[model samples]
Target: MNNKLKLSNEHTLARVLEIKHYTKALFSFKTTRPNNFKFKPGEFVMIGLIIKGEFIFRAYSICSSTWDNVLEFYSIKVPNGPFTSFLQKITTDSSIIIKTKSTGTLVLNALTLGKRLFLLCTGTGIAPFISIISEPGTYIKYNEVILVLTCRYSQELQYFNYKVKQMLKQPYIKLYARNKLRLYLSTTKGSYPYSGRITWLIKSGMLIADLKAYNFNRMDKFMICGSQQMILDVVNLLRSIGYLEGAINNPQDFVYERAFVS
Candidate 1:
């Protein structure tokens, strides 16, 4: 019997360090990061499990800052998802496969200069934003950073809420985050102070009104991640107002990624 791990040249093995479950369906895990592994905030990489001598992989947005020694990922368990069903059962004893390369348009470098940076996401889509916000470079790039997270239930927001609090309390981050970071939570199905889809909140001006922020304009940049429908609706709303989609080579007013959609 062979116990040695086997992986392709482009992949590496990482040991699971910790796991936290936010809800029956939502969970996050941390894994040991290879010394040579590097990525920008908001980028995503392919990760997977080994089963029956076969590797099953999925794209997962990184949830930890680039400077962190360990990599973190947020996930949602699907009833019989090929990857997630097995992934959810993993413990610290497990080792996962991680592809070396990482890429995504949600990165800060994808957007042009802007006064305010708005990060809008739904469900596990909040993963990359967590990495972005935790990066000290993010605070230096914009005068204000707004993170909007919408989920089906209020409980789904607990993990992010705790992360935000931790950032606000960290000495190095608190100084800037306390003044620049703003979080708004919304629930589509359950009771909450804010309710309804984020697209509606934005179009109806309820989100801006609640933030007491200046009206959205060419000078504001947006990063969005969520389901196909959520992304389309939000993109349409922004495009109608003259916002252009951005790319790594071409900087524009907004960018988006669907890595966490599953």
Candidate 2:
């Protein structure tokens, strides 16, 4: 008559460490990582909770640096979502199930050498980019790293702001990436320093003004993660300018992965 929940054959049970709510729809949580669980920054793994005696899982980008002892995830609370609705209710000390297989194309290994690296995202797509920038490899590979994040409201940008500030203040990061990392933000539905779709910004040359470059050349590498439409639009835009898609086996000018499955 044992009632203890048994760990699934393919998943590991992780203890939640902390949780922070950014808005009604967005939140982030940290969970203890398995000592043997290893993954590159920018990769993703399936995570979920048991509901109605069944486990429901969803792919989530690992937001924490690879070096972090705890795993972190940024999530959107979709109303009636199969997993999120339940996930949003998670609290510290709760159990989270994580699949060990972490895979994605957003890692640094998928991009060729370039002088500048652009990390473009919208909403929770910013998750993978957070991991990338925190990894020292990002700073060592490029002289400049540009991070652009667009959200529906200014409040949604708070998590990014905090991470960016922390990255800049760290002695190690400051020494290597000081004055090299740049953050651009836009709020689509509210007033912010920037307001507009990132694609429009790129097409209108406004983003380029900040880039201080007229064209996207081979010297620039782009890692994009966001909505399907956003990924498509940016991919087309980059292709129009001769940027080629890259992969682990054949690194090229750019790489991308969907932030969430639509």
On TM-score, the leading prediction is: 1
Q: Write the per-residue lDDT of candidate 1 for residues 1-262, one digit (tens) a residue.
A: 1367567789988999999998999999999997699999999999988776677788899998788899999899999888898999999999888999988778898899989999999998899999999988898999999999999999999889888887667788777676888899999996899998999999899999999988988789999998878998898999999999999899999998855443
Top-lDDT structure, candidate number: 1
Score candidate 2 by lDDT: 0.86
| Tens-digit per-residue lDDT, 45-112, candidate 2 | 99978887876788899998888789999999999988888898998858888997788878888888
TM-score, model 2 to reference? 0.94
Deviation (Å) of 31 in candidate 1: 0.5
Relative to the true structure, candidate 1 reaches a TM of 0.95
Looking at candidate 2, the ten consecutive residues that score lowest on lDDT are 1-10
